[model samples]
Target: MRRVLIIGGGVAGCATALALHRAGFAPVVFEGHPDSGEDIGAFLTLAANGMAALRELDAAIAVGRAGFPLHTLEFAGGVRELAGHRCLRRAELCRVLQAEVARRGIPLHHGKRLASAAEDADGITARFTDSGIARGDVLIGADGLNSRVRALVSPGAKPRYAGQQVFYGYSRPRRPPCEPGRIVMVRGEAAFGFAVSPGGETYWFARVSTVESPEPSWRESLLALLDKDCAAIVAATRGPVLGTNARDLAQIPRWRTDRMLLIGDAAHAASPATGQGASMALEDAVVLAKAMRDTANPLEVYEQLRRPRVEYNTEASGRMSARLPPMDVPPPVSEEELAGQLDWSRRVELTAAE
Candidate 1:
């Protein structure tokens, strides 16, 4: 039996472990957090491809709990339907993955922040801040966007900020909520806001175009900017803010050195503009697992099989990103506009950028 050590137990890490186990290989997972049950305050969409991968891990039934069908998505003039869509809470999604992993008797080590790693021809060894170490015939870094493992693998793979920033909020329905049958996206100049469902929890992400400002510390500077653009969604929130810098990286030419390889965000990060980050990462995990299972030289197989997918997705995300407008314009600009934003009788229509 072959042993694998995987770093980062978020969506990508847990999925990879489960997939590997089903492929007759069990992988030990290391999560930087103190526990495997904390909520990340974000929801992810499991597209067709992603859903297929989870089913392969025997996790679809559980995944159903973590996610509702994201069947409909709409884009329009800054305020899409306030309701109607299949959604789930981010917490629910993680819980589902973690539960499946536990049921399989997979070992998961939390609070084990990766400190350093060295890969030899035979295997790879990883040192953690928790004063522990793990070694395996193969090492995979599923650590998220800011992947420490990636740094060690390809030092030159710097993340280029995707000139967009998103402010996310979690909330419950107030009175009659936005229509509940679709993922709603409101588009405007250099900004767009969306409402999504995860674990039955309502989630919103507001993106502001950073190209106009060109500032590295734009998050601080653009506080007012986001607030203005995402007025409708902001007003509807009933929970704490789940925020982070929106950024992405394509790939590292030398993703593998000996028995180690990088996967998911560590290898490539697509912009969230197209909302495909989670879906693509899911594909990366399963694709890599399949490649490894089919070949003796897992590294070579994983590299060749996943590179094209990563590159294609990366380019698609960038192209979609370039079409977004720069931040600066405010929404309806008043509570009255919010009230009169959409008429129930009139049909609202949206067209993607040409």
Candidate 2:
């Protein structure tokens, strides 16, 4: 069996571990964080494609327990019913996935930040900041945007600002503007979105175009940019607002070496405007595990299958961040083709073009 060393125990790392274990590989996770509450203040939504990937790993039900389902999207355009989506706290999702990994007796070590890695013909050894080491047949970097492994794989591949600042917060409005299971998008001077939970809490996020970093009173500045209802929601926030610069890796010329590979945000991170970061990571886990199970050159095959789709998302998201109109770019793959690619029972296959 191939022993896979996985770095970063966030969404990508945990999901990769579960998928690899199910495919009969020995995969161990090494996380830099001392605990699982790394991004406790942030929240995200898993679209239908992401939910489908979890289902392929048989983990949808376990993860479904933490988040509530979202069924409708309301915007300047008419409302539309969604296929299958879930909204939840980022830390809560990590907790659920990590708990599932533990339930299956997988090895997960925390606070062991990756320092460096050396690869040989036979295997690769990962050295951690804690002076710990592990030898594995291959290394998979499932780290986040500021990934250390990415530096080793492709030097000078840094994250570029996607031209926006993202802010997140929760509010308890006595009278919620929208019903539960519905996400309302407000497109004013800035792009804003909010979803009300069954318990009457409102989860909202805003993306504002800006080159400079936000000030200490970003909340007040953001309020000034929003309309009356949106401003009211921000004013009624339950706690301090959380904000961050939107960043992404527009392109990475190299994704792997002889015995090392990059996956998830470490490989292809898109801006939050798309809201496809976690979903894309989940899809990577499933496709990569299948490749490892059925290919002689798993790394090469994995990149061929994933690069086109992820790059398309990166480009589209960047355009949205810049407040540009939608381009007529063709999708990398059709929904039917993607379904076939993610299907676990079927053997992995790629078209001639891919």
Candidate 3:
């Protein structure tokens, strides 16, 4: 049996562990963070394709219980409606995935940051920042945007910023304004989005176009960006806000070497605007595992199958990022066009990943 070393205990890594385990491999997941249930990230929307991938792993019900399913997504004051979207706290998603991993008795190590790695004809050895080492027949990089493994595989590659930053926050209002499972988005100066979860918590995000970082804090930046039309959202959200830069990797020329492979954000990160980051990572996990199941040269086959798909998403996301209009201005895309994009994204199929 091959011992697979999976780097980064994130969505990609955890899902990969589960998939690999099902494929008859003993996989160990290494996480740089000491704890997997850190409540630090914002909410994530899992589209239909992502849910389908979870269903492939028999994980849809668990994750669905952790998130809110959206029945309607309205943009630009109800000009269009997007279907088949779901929302969940990113931390909750991680907690649920980690719990599933624990239930299966998978070996997961914390504080195992990858400082470097080297490959031999027999296998690969990963060295951690803490001076620890682990050897396995296969090494998979699931580390995020600044993946150490990525730098080693493609020395010239780096994350490309999307010229925008997003601030996300969850607020419990005395009375939620939006209907449960309904999401509303407005395009002005910047983009302001609001949605009410099943638990009655309102999740909101504001995306502002800027190369320079916002001042005061994420919450302050959000309050300042919203116009009078969205004053209610500004007034409703009083809790702490989390911020993340929108970024993607454009046409990465490398994804694998003998005995090693890269998956998820480590290989091809897409902007949040595309709403494909989490879903794409989920797809990568299942597809790579299937490739492993079917071939002797799994890394090569995985790269061939995944690169074109992720590259297409990367390019689409880049185009979306470039289309963000100036502040206080309305978006350039028409209602029909916006709806078309949303529908297209939701329709992306991952059944083949199973």
Candidate 4:
């Protein structure tokens, strides 16, 4: 079995570990944080495609327990039923995935930040900021946006702001709540979206166009941009609001170097406007593991398979964040084709033609 060294024990890293382990690889994960609580303030939706990937890894039920299901999406047009999408805090998802990683007895080291890495003909060596070292036959960089491993894979590749600043917060709305399991998107002075959890706490986010990022008084500034109902949700919130400039990687000329490779946000991070970051990362985990399981040249095969779909997502998401009219973007891999690709029992090469 190949000894796989995985960097970043977030969503992508943990999921990658689970997939690789099931594929019979000896995978070890190194997390920068001392615990699985990074990004506790922010939440994300894992789309149907992501859930499908989890089911392939036999992790769906464990992960499904943390968050509530989202069945419908409401917008200016109309409400449409969703396929089994889930809404949960980013940290909660990490913790659940990390617990499963532990349950399987996979080795996950904490507080081990990657300072640098060197690869040779024989293997790859990872040096940590804590002065620890691990050597493996292959290294997978699941590190997120602002990835250090990305610098090694594709030098000068950096994430650019997608022309929007996003704010996230949770509130118990005094106003009448929307139906449960429904996500509402409002297009006003800014792009806003919210969902009421099963517990009645509303999870909301606002995206505002700005050349300069907003100040620390994000609540007041954000409320000013929302309509009455949206403003009321923000006003009822009691805690600190989380905000950041929406960012994405336009393209990376390279995604692999011999034994080292980048996956997830490290390889192709899309703007949050698309709500596909976590789903895309989950897809990467399953596909990459399948590549490793079936091929001698996994790095090359993985890139060829993933590049088209992920790049399409990156382009589409960047356009949405910029508030630009949608262009004739290349359509991503079809749903049926992707399902065939993610099927664990099927050999990856057989699905390549679809």
User: What is candidate 4's CA lDDT for residue 141?
Assistant: 93
Provide the lDDT at 224 for model 3. 73
Q: Model 3 Cα RMSD, Å?
A: 6.2
Q: Best candidate per TM-score, number?
A: 2
**lDDT for each residue of candidate 1 in 61-170, tens digit (9 for 90 to 100):** 77875556655566653433322123555567677787788899999888888999987777778898877988888788888777888888888787776766656666
Q: Point out where model 4 deviates above 4 Å.
A: 214-216, 350-354
- The digit string of per-residue lDDT tens for model 4 on 1-354 reads 399999999999999999999999999999988888378788999999999999998889988899999999999979899989999998888999999999999999999999999988899999999899999999999989989899998999999878888889999887645977999999988899999988889999888888656553477678889898999988888687888888899878989999889999999999899999999999999999999999777888888889999999988888888888885855778888899889999887733334
lDDT score for residue 30 of model 4: 96
Model 1, stretches more than 4 Å misplaced? 37-39, 76-86, 172-177, 196-202, 211-230, 324-354
Candidate 3, residues 111-161, lDDT tens digits: the string is 999998999989899999999999999899999888888888888899977
Q: Which candidate number maximizes lDDT?
A: 2
Segments of candidate 2 deviating more than 4 angstroms: 214-217, 351-354
Q: What residue pairs are clashing in model 2?
A: none
> Candidate 2's error at 293, in angstroms?
0.3
- Per-residue lDDT value at 302 in model 4: 87
What is the model-wide C-alpha lDDT for candidate 2?
0.90
Q: Which model, 2 or 3, shows the larger lDDT?
A: 2
Give all TM-scores, in the order shown: 0.79, 0.97, 0.87, 0.96
